[model samples]
Every structure is written in C-alpha cells, then in structure tokens.
Target: MITVPDESGIVPFLRAGPPPDRTRHEGWKRWQDQRDKFIPAPRLSLEEYAALSPRRRALHDLHRTATHVNLGLLETPMSAKVTKLMRGRLRNNALNFEPGTRDGLMVSGGGYLGKTETACDAAATFEALWRDLHRQLLPGPIPGTRDLFVPVAYCRTPVRATPKGLCAAILDFYAAPHPKTLHGMVRQVADSIRVHHTTALLLDDVTRLRLHREDDQDTLDLIRELMDLNVTLVLIGVDIPNSGLLRGGRPDPRTGQWILPPVKPGQTFNPGAATQTERRFDLVDLDPFDYDSPKGIKAWLDHLAGIEDRLRLLQARPGMLTEGAMPEYLFRRTGGIVGLLRRLIEDGCTEAIDSQAEELTVDLLAGIPIRLGNLADRDPTAGEIPEIPEDIAVPAPAPRPRRKGRNTVFDDRGERPAADA
Candidate 1:
C-alpha cells in the first residue's frame, strides 16, 4: 500500500483541523499560509483567483513547482490542439457528467516538443474548471459535500511499460487505509468521482505501452478497466508509428512501443471530432508550432513575451518588441515553432543574466540556441540559395574594374574575382 502523494490533502487541512499531531499540523498550517499568500497575488486576475478553490489552488501550486519547465509558446498547433481538447471537455461538462468515459488519452509528438507541459496544463485547467463548476453546482453551504475539486486518485509517470507493475502502481495510489486491489482501486476511483463527483487517473507517460516483447494483453486489460470504471487516462510522449511502436518500432524494452489503442466501431483518434467511441481514447498530436504563417509567428512571439514578463528572471529585456510587436528576428529565429522560439529566448536570457546585461538584442540572439537550421533542412520549402548576404562581410565582390587590356588576367589562384584584373 504505497501512499501516493497527498495533493488534495492541503485543502482539507485548510478547511478543517487535522488530527492532533502538533508538528504535522504546524507544518500544514505554514504550508496553507504560504499557499494563500501567493495565490491572491496582484498578478492574478480576480476572476482567475475566484475560479480556483483552495484544493485546486494547492494542486496548481504543487504541479507548478514540480512541472514548471518553461512551456515556451502556447500558440503552436500542438498547443492549440491541447487547448481545444480541454475546452471540449469543459464545454461538454465532461467532469460533471460522471460514469464518464475513463478511456484516457495519448499525446504524441517529436522530441523537445512540449508534451509534459501539455499534460500539466491540461491537468491544471481540468482541475480549475472542475472546481469552478462544482462551486456553481452547490450554491449554498452544502453539508456532507466536499468543497475540493476532483482529486488525483493516482498519477504515475512511465507506467512501468509492464502491465502488472502499472496495475500495482495504480492500486498503490489508493494507499493502506483504502483498498489495494485493482477492482478495489477502480471502486475507489468511482467513489471519489461521485464524492467530489470529479476525479481523474492521470498516467502521464503511457508511451511505454507498446513494448514489443511485452505482451500488451495485460496493458489492454488495465485500459479496459479504466474505461469501464470511467477514469480519464492521459498518455504523453513522442509520436508512435503506424504499428503503434513509439520508440521507432524498437524491440528493445528500453525503447518502448506505441500501438494503436483498441477502439469501438465508428471511433477514431481525431482531435477535431465532436464525439468518440465508448472507450474514447482521444489522440492529440502536438505538431511543432508553425512559425511560418504570419498569424502564427505573431502569436508565438507574443506568447514568449508574455512568459518572459511573468518570469522576471530574464536579466536582459527583449528590445523594443512590445507585447504585440512581431519582429522578423523572432519570426525567422523560431522557424515558426513557438517551443524553439521560447528555448532561444530563455537561453539568451540566461546568458544575459550571467553577463549582467540590460537587453537581449539581435546580436545576442544570433548565437542563441536554434534548431531552425535543422528544421530548414527537414523543410520541404528550402530551395537552392539564390543570393548570399552582404552582411556576412566576405564580400561577393561586384564586377571588378577591368584592366585597360581586354585580355583576361588570372590571379595567382588561377580563378578570377574579375574577368580581367
């Protein structure tokens, strides 16, 4: 009975006094105070703060502290897709309509893509929305009803790539005081969903499900259980191939598999669809952001500026590019991928901080880390170089002054900078 991290416990401690463990209570109080202080900070809009319940707020903080890996740009197709999916769930009041499909989800993309952040963002948003809706549902001070949003019954990373271990891990999330068997865990999750009427089982890294040698029968069984029980499953990692092998179809256990989930009739993994099958395993592919389009480029840059503004750790200010300013420098640098642009800016910011600089200029950004070159090589649009830049300083000399003689004069290299020297 391994104790899963008590993410939802903070709210309870804040609401009512915990058991008489003076030291634990003191620590919990301290945590609550700190949480409260930062939550209503001036930066957060009143609406945003109002929407979050204490428990959801605490969970947000925990998730932020643990998962805050600069989520560069939110305008990318991948980012937009994530937003769309979450929005759909909210629109449908999926959390409110329980005995909901617990079939789970899978987010796949290339490397350095923002898969983790996508998951965290979705989790945070879902929790926030759930709390808001729950508050609305219970207008009065309802007795015997919990104020908190859906609790994370179990959230484990890299679900062990093996079925038995993954099942055990999920069961363990219930802990000792609660049930430990799979069926029991399912029941517990179901009850939690009804209790708060909002609960989710987040398997953050399900890319390992496609292990070649490892029989997926057990894995499929567990997924079936989750679906039957109405738990939301979330899978995040790189793009799985056609056969569903995530790690390039490698048979090595180290490089996991990514097979297509078993689906019911007329159901597909398309993110654009309104409804899906009974075991609705939604597929959200986070395609690299398209910085190529004018609109996409502006959105990407604005998002970066916004992030920088939020995280004051940036020592050098990005010059003159106002919140809405779309600089060709940024647009070109990002190669249209918001994630890459963010990496470039953050890396540049870190260097500025180290050097104690005042501004991150085009000069500084020149050396900043970029994958655009590689991206370009992979680009179907990269045509042959028509003209070179004069800024390179290796002057492609204009037609040199011809000698008085019409005869061509060769230089020592036997090649001509001019037809006649």
Candidate 2:
C-alpha cells in the first residue's frame, strides 16, 4: 500500500532511498537491520494484480523492485560449512568453563566469497539461540541496569590496524568506554565482554593486519588475549592464511600442521614468541564454486536452482535458470563466485520485471555487465556458453507447497466446533 499523501502527493516516497553504501554495516544496529530485513514480493494472481488502480500498481512495482534487489544472501554449501563449524566451535567454548584459553575459528576466502555474511549468519543464529535459552535476558543484572545481552560482537580489523585500534573496535561495538592506555583498553574489552555476556567475537577484514609492523604484532597478541575472554573469536578476512595472519607460529615438520606452545591465561606473549592463536583456531578456507568436476557441477547447478526458485517474475519458466545452457553461461560470467552470480541474477530479474520479459535469457544477461572483482581476466569469450561435464545430473528441488487461501466467508466460528476454519 502506498503511503498517505502530505501537502504534496506521493513525492515523499521518491525523496527517500537507501543510505550511502560507504556506511559501515557491521555495527550492532546495522547488523540487526541486515538480519531482520526480508521482504518477499507479492505473488499475485493476474486478475488480482489487474484489479489495482494505476497508482497502487505503480507502488507495487516499486515494491517488487525493492524485494527482488534485496532478496538476501542465499544459503549455499559454503555458508552451511562455515555456519556448522563456527557454531560447533562456539558451543564447544561455551561448555568449557575451565581456565584454559578457548579455541577460535578463522574463515578465509577471496573477496565477495560471502565470508563475512556466512560468519555473521552463524553468529546471529547462535546469538538467537543463546538469547532464547537465557530467556532473552542476561542472568543477574543489577537492578535497573540498562545492559544489553549482546551475545555476539562483530568488528572489522581497522584499515591501519593496531592493538589499541583493535581494542577500540570491540569496545565501540558495545559503546563501551575507551581508555588512553592500550593496557587499559584491553582490560575494558575483557570487562565489556563479561558484562554483555558476549559469546562470540567476529573480527573481520583481518587481512589488513601487517605482521611487519610492531603495532600489528601487538594487535595479534591482543586478539589471543581476547580469546581468553571465554568467547569464540572468529577471524574472517580475505585470504587470511596467506595474509601472514598466522605468522610467528611454525608448522610441525613431520605433521605439516601449524602448532604453537601453549601460553597461560592472562600472560602476555613476547612480540617475537610463536603466536598462541595458530594452534587454537580451526582455519577454514571458503572456496568459490567449482565447475570442473561432477560434484562441483552439481553444486553450481543447485546454487542456480535455489536462486531460480526465489524469483517472483510472473512469466518465469520453471527451469528458467536451472535448465539448458543458462547455468553454465552464468557460471562463466560469474566465474563461480557467489557474489557475482547474485549480482547477475538480481540485475537480470530487475530487467525482466521492468521490461515485462518475466524471465531471464542469455541475451538479457549478456546486456547486463557483471563487475567481476579486480582480479578477473576480463575474457571476451566469458559470455559464451561452455559445455559442462555430461555425467553429473542434478535433480531439481521439489516445488514448495503453496498455501491455500482461507475460506473467510464461512459463517460458523467457535459456535461450530466440528467444522474447520
């Protein structure tokens, strides 16, 4: 429904739109916004839609655009793996009430590989369950205290990250006070986590940390100390393993796995000492979708199918994206990157809705430019459909059951106990 008119007509609607993209979305308030936003475009019967007035229909069209564009990040096998591993670690840490340092999780991947979204998704889910179990309240709050039981804190490793800046970022999440001294700030961080009953700490964009800098090394040390705060520290960044984030710790010669000598809780490590974090974190790399093997091909197809099912185009065919060369065409265009595929589909859907094409075609996608990240080769033949392996056949997902309209015309209510509503 359109908003009521003011002194002017519906011009107010046109005046407002989403804010600047540069605004950080990792804050608690902004993160909650992302978590709670889900607006499904209405699937109206042709007759029902035709009955709307011109203004109402136009407003509906505006709604359709908003819904399609922000359909939200779809779950893929990649996000599932991250969520499972992360939640498992968080649960494990929560159960360990002993004094030893809790282990953490690191999600490493290329840019636009849905690393932050996956980590955040898992964190948010864990927070919801935690809140429910605690009845949405932290136990034993001082009377009349306005404390928020945050459960999860998300922060980006500063662009020019340092130990103090890192501490500030965590404190900033809770609007906790910052101290002038690095030691004081670190103390504030631990105290804040305890006060808020935070269970998971997500430090994203860790690739920005440079091991060569002394302040960066101190920051790494601070991160390990934060782990002892009894929260599962989840480090998310682009190409973390290669980013020198796991430096200082040496890999075992025989086992060929990262290892470090354990440090006692509350003890600071020598700047040159082996990183206490390397052995404690289960570092998982999130790879982009693969199209080379049978299993890989099936995963790619399944991903496309998931997107296809969510499409609200009135004229969309059942297999608009899953069937024929479209999937492969999309794969080539996106290079199996989830972010790129989403952009391609969202843009295509927008075009389809406005043009009345009602379905995605190769030509429509061809006209749509996908901004493959800075690294792509920009190959001309990318738009050309390549043949996928013939053997692996992926079955389409079962169509979801539609909800039957209610019979509101029935006269009997509670008076007729035997009749269905």
Please give the CA lDDT of all the candidate structures.
0.47, 0.70
Q: For candidate 2, lDDT tens digit of each residue in 105-149?
A: 788877668887788777777776776778745355568875467
* Clash number by candidate, in order: 9, 0
TM-scores of all predicted structures = 0.52, 0.76
Best by lDDT: 2
What's the distance in Å from true for residue 418, model 1? 49
Q: Write one digit per residue (lDDT tens) for candidate 1, span 144-225.
A: 9534344334344333344445555554444323455544544554455455443555564454455554445446545544
Evaluated against the true structure, the overall lDDT of model 2 is: 0.70
Query: What's model 1's lDDT at 113?
Result: 62
Q: Clashing residue pairs, candidate 1?
A: 102-231, 104-233, 105-233, 210-257, 244-258, 244-259, 245-258, 246-258, 291-336
